[model samples]
Target chain A: MDTLNLEGTEDTPKVILDKENGIFELSGRSLPEDSAEFFQPVLDWIEEYSNDPNSETVFEVKLEYFNTASSKLILDILSDLAEIEGTTIVWYFHEDDEDMEEAGEEFSELVELPFEFKTY
Target chain B: MQTQDLILIYEGEFTQDITKAVLSMAERNMDSSGEESSVKRKVFNVMVECLQNISKHAESFDEKSKAKNNAIFMIGKQEKEYFITSGNIVRKDSVDSLKNKLDKINSLDKSGLKELYKEIIKAGKLSEKGGAGLGLVDMARKSGNKLKFDFEPVNQKFSFFSLQTTIHRS
Candidate 1:
């Protein structure tokens, strides 16, 4: 398994997925110049990880903000992660942000895999 | 119908610069009024989303033109309501897809739209061009009004898309 390193941009976030340790994170804002181009690699990485089969995968997302296009990619990533065997997903949000929490819940509602939503 | 409210016109070469300017303006001066900041934030958010739609999905307005990235965004307030307008060129193939999505969204009731949004979410089928189709639905729900749109054809293979949304003062 190979690690993923994507430098952050003004409109989009930095996504670092360490394939060796199973620590994946998406942090910062997301309103990419083009959603498909930016997200395709991440999708590719997860597709590879799904085959390797990890016991647990913790995802840390501290996105100060993300746009509608990015929202689709994030959900797509979550959905893909949900399909792999023996993997666990956890999401964290700001303590006072009800909207973010709701967004997380809405995503959790669709995924069949086990997910834990936490407020920090 | 320009009364006493401030008017804004953004004609620029890049979408990010203009969106940043507007967001900063709202962030800095939103305290001047008694309106809730969240209300102001929502209005600004929708406008940005629409602009994102343009920058990503819109068709190139010109072949020989150097300002292909350029777009127009307008904002104004009237009678305790804020109006935001954004325009950009889009391809012919994009027109029907966008229209169908908007029409479908307009037809849904509150709960129905929610269900549809979820269905689309779970189905995980993405827009051909990578759009989520969630932005307009969120705008419809937030504004509490049906979304209004127009498509003006530039030629056989291209057209311009204009979207207008308003949020009332709280």
Candidate 2:
């Protein structure tokens, strides 16, 4: 699958879904005013990637701050990953950011996928 | 009034640019004051919800009314907590539902809020404005406090709606 790279903005996260280089990560703040519009391409990319996923997919989510809208879309993205076997989510949060940690935990509980929590 | 505790206040239309500017300003103020990362996240979360809520729902009175698309946002620092307050114009007909939503959120306890959050996200009901109706719940959950709100009638068709969310500094 072709890589889907989107640079981060003040209200959107940086997304890198490069199958060739084996890098799948999203990071930064994600509180776009139009989250659905902002995340549509990402959702589409993930859907296409699902058809021929790698042997083991380790998607990283290193968001500092995301609004509730983005939170729901994050869950959707994780759900998509859950459908693909051999997929693990690497959730990174700031050391003192309890809310982000808890968010990751909640996503782990809801989705049937392995999650590794790391603090930066 | 600009008091020592008053961090920032904005009143006018809520364009995406204006929202970003105000949020960054508040963030800078919080960072410079040496606020803990956790507490700052809570405040930032609540502020974003409040401002985005206004941007999405604030009703314009009429094409010619001066209050069209106008709203107010204020953040202040008290000794023990930070308060984020927002007010916007809304149609009088929409007041009841908005009030009910706030009341329901304020009445819930922590675990109750967690359950509601989970339920709402699972339901995945995204509004036309790109909201899942989770803003109020998220604000309540992040702040860990009851949402305070009021509505004042502006005219027959519209009212001024105000909401306040508080995040403790501890």
Candidate 3:
């Protein structure tokens, strides 16, 4: 699959999904006005990537903040990845951000996937 | 009349640009107040959800009100807690549902709120405006307090809805 790269905006997050390199990243803040529209393509790409089944996938998620709408879409992304094999999710949070940390823990509990929490 | 504790007040149309400006202003104010990063983050998070809620639900009032697509947002501090309040006009029909939602959210404890948040997210039902209807749940969870709100009838067709969330500094 071709690499899907999207630039982040004031209300959106940056996304880079490289199938060949097995690197999937979503960083920055995500609070788009229309989250479903903004995340539709990303979800589509992930669905397509699931078909090929990368040998090893590293999903890096470093989000400063996201609205509740984006939160649901994020869980959708994580749930999709949970079905694949050899998928590792790296959840990043600021050292002092308890909300984000709890968010990571909640997602960890909801999904059956390998999650590594890293604080910056 | 504005209260002495008022730190920020914004009344106007809520666009993406306005949201960014408000967030920046609130961040600067919070920083200057010498709050810890965690406290500031909580305030910021609650503010975002409040603003977004207004932007999503705010309806244009009748000509008599002279406020078209305009909402009121205010941030005030009392002692060690910060209060964020937002008021907007909504269709009369939506008042009951909105009030019920807030009541349901306010009744939950932290764990209950967390469970509701997870359930809503997993259900994946976005609003017509593409929201997961998790804003109220998030506000309750982040503030660790019940959401206070009221709905005042404006006219037969519209009502003014107000919501307030409180964040304690620790």
Candidate 4:
């Protein structure tokens, strides 16, 4: 699988998913008019990636902000990643932002995917 | 003509800069009072997100009205509480989705919201337009209050979004 890299704009965030390293990352902000359209491909790639079953996958998500619809898509990405065995997700948040930390912890609860929370 | 503590309405070029200036003005006024200052910041953060959301998501109105895609964002305090109001234009087709998100968030309690927000964050997708599906939920949590919104029909296809949220200072 080729690396998927999407740049962040005034309204959207940057997403860089490395296939070889099995380290997929999506950061910055996201809130597009057609969210389903934007995220569909990313999800599709994840689906294909999961099938190959990498030995270990490291997914990193560091976002300053995003919108409600994008929130749903985040779940879709993480849950799909979880399906692949031995995948580890590193969720990072600002040290002071309890909300972001809580968000990651909350997301961790919903999925059995192995996750580690870190603050920087 | 009536004079309250503050009254400001601007449209056209440099709209965001002007709106932010007015925000700072409010902050300066409340600087002397501690509780009021923190509350004002909370309200101000919400107001910024509200305005930015409008600027980022609003479609077509900036061209039609020649407002430069600017929005009307007002912040005022009364009765020991602060009220932040914002308005902007968006395509008719997009209104339903926006409303649904707000409605869903408004309906959830802390725990319910925790679950719902997580699902959206982990499973949700990103749009090219630059949002991660996190702003509104962050707004709701930050304010420690529910978000209030209104969408008015502007044309056959576009609707105006007016969002209001208030913060009380103890």
Candidate 5:
């Protein structure tokens, strides 16, 4: 599969999905006016990547903040990844950001995948 | 109408650009206030949700009102808290639904609100505009306070809706 690399902006996150490298990451803020539209392609890529399956896949999420709309799409992405074996999710939060830490916990509770929480 | 502690007030169209401007302005204002980073982030997050709510749900003015995309956003600081308020015209038919949503959010305790937030996200339902309907839940959850709101009838076809959330700088 082709690598999916999208630059981050003030309102959107940077998405990098490299199936060959077994590395998938989403970083920065996500509050797009139309989240479904912004996330559809990312979801499509993940769905495609799942068919072939990477031997060991790592999904990293480093979000500063996200709107409720982006939150649902993010959960969808994580849920999709949970179906594949050998998938690990690394969630990053700021040191004093309890909200982001709690958000990571919530996502971990909802999805059946290995989650690693790291603070910066 | 400007007041002493009013940091920002925007009236008129609520576009994506305007939302960015508002967020940046609010961020700068919060930064200068010498509050803790956590409190600033909370205020900024709530402000984004509030602005997006207006942009997504606010009713555009019709011939009756002669106001195009009429909306109002205000941020004020009072003692240990920052008050974020937004008002916009909405379709009369939506008044009841909005009221019920706000009332339900206001009724929940912190844990209950957290549970509700998780449940809604798990449901995976998005509005026609691609919203997860989690804005109200988020505002309530982050503020650690009750969500305040009011709806005033405007003619027979529209109602002016107002919502306020507070962030404590503790």
Candidate 6:
């Protein structure tokens, strides 16, 4: 498919999903007022990408903070990625951000995908 | 010495722009005070939940009745901890469900809260308002405190609901 890139804002995250380049990452803060609306295209892209996913799909999530509303969308994204084989999640959190780390753990527990946790 | 400082206070209609501004103001306040990164994250997260909760109170206001459309948000810093509080108008019919949710959240211990949070996140369906119903649970887990709330009937159809969440500095 085509690459989907979005710039981060005060209330949204930076998204870079490139199936050709093999880069699927979401970074920065995510606290959109309407998370379902904001993440709709991304979800659609992931659904489309799953059909022709790369051999070793690694998705990186390096969000500093996300609202509970966005949390559900994050789960939706992760669940879509889980359907593809050989997919893994690289969850990054700041050394001082225990909440982010725990968030990664909770997402890992919810999804069947393997997660590699790293501290920045 | 014990001192209580009011960091931020906002009272008006809760819009998306207001939510962003409120969060950024609270974030800057925490930054200026030189709070630890962990504590600052906790405060920020709780504030988002509180503010969003107010935005979800759409039934409290109707175009015909303009008297009950406003909400209040305040953050105060004490010597040992910081507190985030919010009050909004809600429909009388929602009072029972809202109270039940808060009471259930307050009754749980840390581990219990964590378990409940996981359970809800895994299975809870999103409301039309795009809420996963995990805001209160996440707030309790993040602040590591019991959720305190009150409801006062205003007329026969609406009630004023106030909620307070506390985060420790340590």
Compared with the true structure, all predictions reach lDDT values of 0.74, 0.91, 0.89, 0.70, 0.89, 0.89
B118 in model 2: Cα distance from truth in Å?
0.7
DockQ of 6: 0.83
TM-score of chain A of 3: 0.97
Q: DockQ rank, highest first? A: 5, 6, 2, 3, 1, 4
lDDT of each residue in B1-170, candidate 5, tens digit only: 53448999999988788999999988887788777899988998899888988888888747666555669999999877899999998999888888888888888999999899988888768989777889989999999999888888888888888899988878
Error of 6 at A31 (Å): 0.8
In order, the first chain's TM-score in every candidate is 0.90, 0.98, 0.97, 0.93, 0.97, 0.98
Q: For model 1, how does the per-residue alpha-carbon lDDT over A19-105 read when each residue is reduced to its tens digit? A: 777678888768765687889999999998888766777777777567667777888888898787766666777775555666777
List native contact recovery per candidate, as a fraction of 1: 0.44, 0.75, 0.81, 0.33, 0.94, 0.81
RMSD, one per candidate, in order: 3.8, 1.9, 2.3, 6.5, 2.1, 1.6
Model 3, A71: alpha-carbon shift in Å? 0.5
**Cα-based TM-score, every candidate:** 0.76, 0.96, 0.93, 0.62, 0.95, 0.96
Greater lDDT among 3 and 5 belongs to 5
| Candidate 3 Cα deviation (angstroms), residue A44 | 2.0
Report residue A110 deviation for candidate 2 (angstroms).
Answer: 1.7
Better of 1 and 3 by TM-score: 3
Model 4 chain B worst lDDT run, 10 consecutive residues: B1-10
Better structure of 3 and 6 per DockQ: 6
Candidate 3's DockQ is 0.78
**CAPRI quality band, candidate 6:** high
TM-score, candidate 1, is 0.76
B-chain TM-scores per prediction: 0.85, 0.93, 0.93, 0.80, 0.92, 0.93
Candidates 1 onward: DockQ, in order: 0.39, 0.81, 0.78, 0.19, 0.88, 0.83
> Of the pair 2 and 5, which is ahead by TM-score?
2
The TM-score obtained by chain A of candidate 1 when compared with the true chain A:
0.90
Alpha-carbon runs more than 4 Å astray in model 5: B1-4, B64-68
Task: Give the higher-DockQ candidate: 2 or 6.
Answer: 6
